[model samples]
Target: MVKKMMQRILPRAFLGKPSLLRRSATASQSTLAQTVQENEPVLPKMPPFDYTPPPYTGPSAEEILSKRQQFLSPAVFHFFKNPLNLVDGKMQYLFDENGKRYLDAFGGIATVCCGHCHPKVVDAIVNQTKRLQHSTILYLNPAIADFAEALASKFPGDLKVVFFTNSGTEANELALLMARLYTGCQDVISIRNGYHGNAAGTMGATAQSSYKFNVVQLLMPSIHLTFISSFACVSKTGVHHAQNPDQYRGIFGSDGSKYARDVDDIITYGTSGRVAAFIGEAIQGVGGIMELAPGYLPSVYNTIRKAGGVCIADEVQSGFARTGSHFWGFEAHGVVPDIVTMAKGIGNGIPLGAVVTTPEIAKVLAHRSYFNTFGGNPVCTAAGHAVLQVIEQESLQQNAFTVGSYLKQRLTSLKDKYEIIGDVRGRGLMLGVELVTDRQLKTPAKVETLHLVDQIKDFLVDVMDYTLSKM
Candidate 1:
């Protein structure tokens, strides 16, 4: 309703799932394929899909850009110098204003688990919206209950209770609050180079400086207001970012136990050896798809539990079968998290997120009434349920495993061919290609990467190698 209302208020603003698009590339795109391996590697052919999106007749990209600059926040940005005015989506393909088609590989940052505007998901959303849209949690709604049960059933151990939110930020914030309440401690730990959200606690817990802003001084009313109105978006006050167990770039190398020791040292020396939670993404999506080193999560989870902390798995980008080999990303790490927060893929492309935890730990919320107006709205929940069904019915997880493995295998070969490709990491479709000028030094090839990006942009398809710091 809000997005629909916005459409009327600001014509040609945006509609449906947000699009990350760029203009079609020039013939120079051939450079990537030509820049292949020593064995003369051939790029994989994209699987053919039968459907075609309806013709697009929308405002031109220039018009949309003019309106956006005049009306939207200056901070809002998109890829490529000339951004794409995408108008329609069908399954894994997107259409620009000119009706030019492109295959979607990013999967809307891993949100389109069942694909964009999937028939099942759309049918569920439309059917549910036709009956009821919003009734808050005060009233009994089968959509919320049924979907919650189905989602919880997918988790291991006692993570059977679910709390809904409109975005990953809210889910993570709620998880932080629950952890603090459960452990009765203020100190929280997160992995370095991981992104949680942009809200207060989540932003603080997020380790990457790129995702944070200054003016977090809560007491500085004027600066804080100027920064984010009434919101405090910075300050790692009680948050401790543990050393990232990055195999390719971390100081500890691939010895995951050595990196886990850093968390133990933090607990022993920092705070009072008590922590509220330890939050980590099994595969660091925002951190250039860097996965936690093998044996890292198990050891860190044990140490955090010993410190009286709850282990929180932030699965915003890697959950809902995106990881291929596992339903949830943490499952790949061989540990059960006390609290699991997810979004992105939960409702396919809809704005939905959830925090699932054990029933015992969930009771802490009973101490105070907590409510979200649009957290589990019937339409979103219904779509979320449909997404789950589609994942099972279509067996997207197995498909991810099969396809992602092939893609990764090809990319690894490229690493051998090109010295610029310093690392190829990540699981399933959530993959990354890091570029370097020198293999031994692992020097980031920022300029070359940007040039390559400018060359292909989002017109890229069946990609295997290329990218610098992604900086």
Candidate 2:
């Protein structure tokens, strides 16, 4: 068995920096804003502490390689074939065992929303652990109840019921179960290139083949795949518009001619077997953070609902104000889903997931005996509460809109400058820069993209070491 090493611990900062908006605003404006702001005087501004207990930097890369390889655990996924011996992280930065910090552009696949190890989140976790940590699901926990209420209030309509889980996959899994039971249908529809999760039930809902191709032996039954159209919108004369107004155009009816008819044809062909549910990510996460075209989700949801199928929005990556303009990505499309699954940024860095649905849907899923040992335990729920509070108090959602827009603007400009950049898309901080060999052909520059990624990694690792040199 591979042995686990004692990973370096990074102490939580007790205080946070003053909100930048406060610093920038005039005294009068700041006073007025504070009065109206829901939670003024957010987290206390903390000074940066000496993260290093002591300094001892002697190993070079060659030495570290030999040492690390000797202690390497086979259990790790080895992302990008490089084992990132991460030691600590703060705000949008991660540090390796060697005390090198990285910009953390990926945000652990868009999980770290309020930055890493936020003071409020850390304080909640630490304080809650002192009072109560793990509480059985059989008992009602105040923290989880508060968290559920806060989360429910964020969404539209009656998405009040919540089922807590350990990860996005679990959330999606629960969502699948809920949808099936609610609709009383066996067949599930997933948009092509849409990723749900890796669980057996969710894997069935996932349409991406790359992640599920080898798992054929364990794949679930009654899974149906359909394309969300990627075709560009054109005028009657066939002159295409560079930007399509509708994001979900391709999935339900992307054929330029007889789009609805094409959808109807598929629905009719599949009708012999009733579709229990249709699940899709509000915004495709791994499938390039691709936003749905206008009228796409609404049309698809309507179609699925008309077919007596419940619509599920897998908001694992697109929920909780990450998309800038709206609180949820589905809201952007004006489509309301029967079920919504979420994780990642919900509890900041804490491991937490939730499946929110209408009472009508929840009542149906209640048939199966469901229990989680630690889902929505006091501490995790407290952390989630803290995260939501931070999001509101600091106006992080608005920040996501402003800063994310700025970042996107910069990235788009970069795309214009760099011939290798094919497409730059995403809302707020959840952006993607698709690198391509030829802009005209839109050929993905895989090699160049990898090289650029490496360059960025190196720069972050070497140049950003000072902040966490002793971690």
Candidate 3:
């Protein structure tokens, strides 16, 4: 319904501006009409009239909020609040139904890579719809093959086989299945505060209280959850003051230096040399953007691999050039995983996800009956390809790095000025600001954090409202 409205409105918008177009004459016609002979390719002229947007006529914020309360869903109960009736989105902005825009710093939890509805992604989707949309995986789809090739080529070794899913959670679930199938073991190790997904199987892999509490039961009973490290490698969770040590701390210090060592010991001696997989996000996302120590990931992967286990990098939140310095977050740490699960920004806002793995693991998972209905649909793959292309062409990943650094610097300054910021850390655009009540005893200021978030949203609404009124 919304798509139809956009098509009608956009074409009318394009045609209405004759002056915006430039006409070029054909070679033969140009000889006859010198005035039109500008040595340019022949094209239709644009109509003249300033492109004025149709004014927003949706429900006001208050009215919409009131109405949302009446239409409840189990999904909404799971998230932060009622999802916004977002009317339009463009680079770095999400316009609410009332046309108020937000800066979109969080990028919808860092899913939007280039930006919301990037022009290239929009054009790709529009063009793809006119061609083909879906084809069963049972039959061959050229677009899917092309996407798989390009995606695999980006990686180093034989981590090449690709499987598409509708979301990151699904991707991780598939990757987990692959791990178990290959290792023939049930126990898996995930870092503390790390989040994989909300689905039945993936939920068991995630080690968050919030997600775990509401879950009816352990959907994947064999899965084991373990804490790798706190938000900042602290002794306990929450806001606590700790000197940001410039040096690498071994896993056997006054701090939980032995945290990773202990985990390794448990996986080795405790589990008696049997472990299925070690799954981790390149950077913890819902776990508050905790970065892995410089050598932490590689060390853990080596430990797991030596135990005949697979190491899976859950790149759902951290892939697709969101991590500025390198396209993949794991790249920054100089470690490669046996399998990589991805989503969020893969389609630049289109619903898509994937698992890229070594041929060995891929073959094992293939033997198991695994299938995704909308996985690697032609249209979605086209959008995905366009997004990847745009990120490179527009140097958006570089933008994420440079602009993200600036944003982080600004946040760091804010942290110094305000006592509430406990720690500010992240790479490229995948950044987080840990809030605390007291610097010394780092207590998470949950209420204060929510208040600040609300304040930021309110400010954007006010500023955008005033700007629109002037126009």
TM-score ranking, high to low:
1, 3, 2
**Which 10-residue window of candidate 1 scores lowest in summed lDDT?**
14-23
| C-alpha-based local distance difference test score of model 2 | 0.65
For model 1, the superposed segments whose C-alpha errors exceed 4 Å read 1-49, 217-236, 458-471
Report how far residue 180 has shifted in candidate 1, in Å. Answer: 0.5
Clash tally, candidates in order? 0, 12, 16
TM-score on alpha carbons, each prediction: 0.84, 0.75, 0.77
lDDT of 1: 0.78
Over 271-383, each residue of candidate 2 has an lDDT whose tens digit, in order, gives 43345676777678898877765566677677667777787888889987898888888888787888898999988867899999888888875677878887888888899
Most accurate candidate by lDDT: 1
Candidate 3 local lDDT, 275-371, one digit each (tens)? 7778887778887787766666667777778877888898999898888998898898788889999998898778899999988778885565877
What's the lDDT for all of these models?
A: 0.78, 0.65, 0.67
Question: Which of candidates 1 and 3 is the stronger one according to TM-score?
Answer: 1
**Which segments of model 2 are wrong by more than 4 Å?**
1-76, 79-83, 213-263, 461-471
RMSD of each: 10.7, 14.1, 16.3
400 in model 1: Cα distance from truth in Å? 0.4
